[model samples]
Target: MRSEFERRHPGVRIQIENIPGEGQYVPKLLMMFVAKKAPDVMHLDASYASVFIDNDLLLDLTPEIKSDDSFRLDDYFTNVVDVARRGDKLFAIPLDFTPIVLYYNKRLFDEAKVAYPAKGWNCDDFLAKAKALTIDNHKEPGKKQYGMHFINWMPLWIPWVWTEGGDVLSPDGRHAEGYFDSDKTIRAVEFLASLITKYHVAPTHSEAAAAGVDLFRAGRAAMHIAGHWMIIDYRSDGIDFGVAMLPTNAASPKTVVYESGLAINRSTKKRELAWEYVKFMTSAEVQKVRVSGGLAISAQKEVAQYYASDEQERTFLNAVEFASGPWGARVEPYAVVEDLGREMMEDIVNGTPVPDAVHKTCRLIDLELSQQ
Candidate 1:
């Protein structure tokens, strides 16, 4: 991708710094900025973009957007484009995004003679399908089937809580007092726990660990809640899969969007060139190449349609309209929040009272936020 850009600017060299893992990228990038040696252009994830933006280490692209008459912001999905925006200032042009959705095994649903999931299905409908699809093979234990796949990852499961009108943080990202331990949140937490413990449709944490593989990908589970990125592996495994809007208990569906974009350093000497580079990377022509691998839904609406060869892919495009940005996109200490959420779930699954677990977790989350 860097080579493609360098070819356009004959004398210029686009030096790419590849940071290899999470928890390291932001610190390394921040150090570069502190030392006045940051790169002109950087690949930014919407989740951690807040750290850089809050410190004013990245350039606001609003002026460039106004000056460039040929560039069109309408080309991209509106939800994703707003990820890097803070009031009047825009920071990045979205390259791609993945909205969290429910993935189901078509083969399993057919085998169970269960109807496929449809949009606007409620939590009751989801539970009924899950119950029907589950198979307990006491004789052939290795061939047992589960209705749903459960993972304790907070980000992946938060949408369920959201659909129930519960959240871990306030709208302004201030505190978690009323949100995380509220009556609605407690119900959401207990309901998720019941899927594994009481309903026995989803595997327990210990059972999943014993399996040592992705139950959904391995065809041992009928339903999984995840983002678009899982499609690559599912297709490679030859699994006939379908995507659907997550079941909601509220008036509407709610899901989180994880996105990646391009940004310019505030100190870059080649400001205009950096802006051009950002535009080029997010251009529909470039996005077409990027989404061919099924990595993510292109932020460009037209490119997303071009990328969608089948109904499964089209569902992702439809989902983009209802998805909202993740909390990590704006809250700097969200990693700590995620840790607490996981711990709370673990406590519940291991015999702790749901109310007690939520109360403890909510208090810890507030303490973590106070430190920030």
Candidate 2:
């Protein structure tokens, strides 16, 4: 990224700062902001973008994007633009999006001789294939292979609900109103839980982390439900795998995708300069480079075309077309809603009934939204 910046603008200099992980990103950035030494530009999760924007810390890039006659906003994906929206205002433009994909060990499938999931395949196929890959502890006790592994995170689970034609919040985003009470939501949670409880095809969060992706890397689990970020890790391990679209019920085939984008610090004196850098970062040319380098899935249609040469890349891009909104799905008071959802998810995964967990989460979400 720094090289690209330097090459493009000879007179300008670039400095790249490395942050440890997603967990520490915000608090550290917030400290920088408090010290009035925030970077000219920074990448932020769409979920947490509102925090900086709400505090008037983000520069409104609308004028720069509009005034620049060369900027064509239509080139980017609609969902990317939609996610960056803050109450009808455009504060930032998306650089890339991370779409969820179901990765399976092709070698394991070949060994088990189970069929691969095609583009139009549904959850029924997923279950059948997973079962075929799963070996019962008592029967095939020699091998400790499971069918699949989920992150046990809500971001990963949201798609299951969406596939069942359910969401976390109401249309108006005013209150949760028990969206989880829907049969669709219940069924989705049940299906996910059954992989562990009934089929023995998946492990709980603790077990998976202790084992790590080594289970999948060693072809233990036939399939893994994960995001694009796993590409680097899997690639480094030199495993033979195939990325497939996230499975869904035929009735509602839209998969769920999560994303984040870059926002310029409003307090920066070089607001115009920051916008220019942001514009360049999200442009098709730059985005294409980023995507081709396996950095991210660019939001621009033209940039997204860069992934066409690779089969898994192509699979992920195609999956985005059927993608649904993020887990919380609402824009306002995102942190509160996300925390509430996370707590409920942990409760249900730890053995609480789905109905009780859903009800509790919905009530908490309602209260949070009301406070907002």
Candidate 3:
């Protein structure tokens, strides 16, 4: 991409500095920003765009997008594009995204004589299949297979909240007073907890870690609710897996969407050149190259068609239509919200009353938002 961009524009050179991982990427970028030495063009996680925008550190791309005849913002998914905006102004253009979906082990379903999950299955259907697939030691000595595997992460659990018709914060993103502690949200937490404490269909946090194997990859769990990034790794491992949309609950089916976009530093002297690079990076040619290589779901709708070689891969592309961005896109102090959310889940897994955990976490989130 750098070579092509340089070829397109004579006398202009592009140097790429790759950051290893998300853990070190954000801090290093922040330090560079503080020193006014940040790159003219950089990638920003959708979750942290609000923070950079709040700090007035990101360039507003609205004018450039509006003026460019070749860039049709409507061609991209509405929700994904919305994540890069703070009201009417766009700060970046998304390059790629991955939406959460249901990944099931076909071998396990066949062995249990259970039908594969169909489209638009509800929570009741999920529970029934999970119960049927779970195997106890009495059934088979020294081998116990769980029905589902859930990692204790905010992104994994937030879909439960959304499916149950609940949210972590208010629509205006000001407070979490009633939303987080409401009956619907508590019910979601209770249902997730039931997978461990009540139904015994999923492994506890400690048990999963101690097992030293990914339950889904090892074929010890029948279903895993995760993102598209796992497809390549699972395929390489020779696991017989299939994909389906996340089951519906009280509301329509929903899942969390994660995306990374390219944005320019607000203080850059080379705004024109940076915009050109951003346009080229998200262009159909570049996106096609990325999708063909199985890197990620491309941001362009036209380029995304390259990945639909199988039904499972097609399921992932279809899932993007209904996926919504994470709560951090709207709420400030999202790190605090994420930490408190994980802590609340841990409390539930440790046997704290669901209602009590929800109430306490709600208060803590409200306090954090108030201070901001």
Candidate 4:
């Protein structure tokens, strides 16, 4: 990737540094910033942008975007653009959007005599099909099958909260709104839990990791809710499954999305060059490489559509329309917000009330934002 990037632009050196996904990135960037030696242009995960932007370490490229003839603002999805915008100002341009979808085992559906999920299917439809796919051990003691396999984690389940008409924050971002304790939120959480306690369509969290995707690979589970990143892995496994849009309540929006992009370092001397590199990265050329290469959902509308030429990719693309940024989706203090989500997920897995969990998370973030 670096070789190709460098080949495209002579005299421009590109260095690829590997780092762990979670906490490692923030401290590393912070140390570099302290030394005033942060990279001119680099790709960062969505979660770490808050710290960098908060410290005034990222360049403001809004004017450049507005004035540059070569940089077309209308080429990408508005949701992606909104994600990179904090306080009505652009900090970065989204390189890709991550949409979570439902992957169903065709063979399992056939065995259970359940129909495939159509694109606009609703939550009731999902529940009915899930129940149909669920197999009780009493009928087949040696071979136990579940209708669904859930992560017991919120990242995997956030869509349902949205589908139930709940959200993480108010439009103004002043207070916790729909997501934590709303009726819709409770309904979503209960529905998710029913897969285990009531319907018996899923395994416990521990059971899932020990088993991994084997259950789906072996036709033991009817469906799995996952991000677009797993398409290649599943394709490699050679499973006879199909991808579909996540089922939503009739009253709710029909989509969910997670996006990440590139921001220029404000502290760098070469701000114009840095912006150029970033501009190029989100442009159609590199976006094609990213999407077609199965790396991510490209921010470019054309590139995203091109990647969706395949059936599986089509399902992923259709869901992008209904996408929402994570709570810390655009803000610079995303790490702190993400940390709150992580803690809330832990509480959910530990049997805490969903409202309480979300409330606690909200309080923590509110405190952090106050401190900041």
List lDDT for all candidates, in order.
Answer: 0.90, 0.76, 0.86, 0.73
Candidate 2 lDDT over residue span 88-180, tens digit each? 677778888877778998888998899888866887888999899986667755457888866666777677778777777777666677576
- Tens digits of per-residue lDDT for model 4 on 185-231? 67777777767766777876666666655677677788998877777
Q: Among all windows of ten consecutive residues in candidate 2, which has the lowest summed lDDT?
A: 323-332
Candidate 2: where is the Cα deviation over 4 Å?
1-18, 137-143, 210-213, 250-252, 325-333
How does each model score on TM-score?
A: 0.97, 0.87, 0.96, 0.88
For candidate 1, the 10 contiguous residues with the lowest summed lDDT are 14-23
Sorted by lDDT (best first), the order is 1, 3, 2, 4
Q: Count clashing residue pairs in model 4.
A: 10
How many clashing residue pairs are found in candidate 1?
A: 0
Clashes of each: 0, 0, 0, 10
- What is the TM-score (0 to 1) of candidate 2? 0.87
What does the lDDT come to for candidate 1?
A: 0.90
For residues 90-198, could you state the per-residue lDDT of candidate 1 as single tens digits? 8889999999999999999999999999879999999999999899999987667999999999989988889899988999998999999899999999999989878
TM-score winner among the candidates?
1
Better of 3 and 4 by lDDT: 3
